[model samples]
Target: MTTFDKVVELLVDAKDCEKDSIKLESTWADLSLDSLDTVELVMNLEDEFGIQLEMNESLKTVGDVVRAIDEGLEQK
Candidate 1:
């Protein structure tokens, strides 16, 4: 699966949410992800992609996370 798909998968698993409910436009708040959950997700992404992510408010959507990972990959 692509990075976007993997991120979505991780989010779903991390939040214990429905897989079908996750979309590119879905917001972290909408997914019920708190600060701790976001941190956990970031750690998972870091481990999976071998990139560190600065936890910022700018990442409001799933697409944002995907783009961040893509950019991180490009830098690598």
Candidate 2:
């Protein structure tokens, strides 16, 4: 699956939320995820993508996460 698709799956599985609500523009607040949840999700993304991610405040939306993963994969 694509990066966005994988991110969506991870978020849905972790949060037990619907896939329809997880768009690129969707923010953490929109998904009802707090800082702890965001941290766990980042760990999951690192393991899932086999890439390290330096957590940042700018990553406020799902699209940002996807972009980070894509950039990580590119570096690998």
Off by over 4 Å in 1: none
Report the CA-based lDDT of candidate 1 relative to the real structure.
0.86
TM-scores for every candidate against the unseen true structure: 0.91, 0.97
Per-residue accuracy of model 2 over 1-76 as CA lDDT, tens digit each: 8999999999888888689999999999999999999999999999999999989898999999999999999999
Backbone clash tally for model 2? Answer: 0
Model 1 C-alpha lDDT per residue in residues 25-47, reported as the tens digit of each score: 88888888888888889889999
Candidate 2, residue 61: Cα displacement in angstroms equals 0.4
How far off is residue 8 in model 2, in Å?
0.5
Which candidate tops lDDT?
Answer: 2
How high a TM-score does candidate 2 get?
0.97
In candidate 2, stretches whose alpha carbon ends up further than 4 angstroms from where it belongs are none
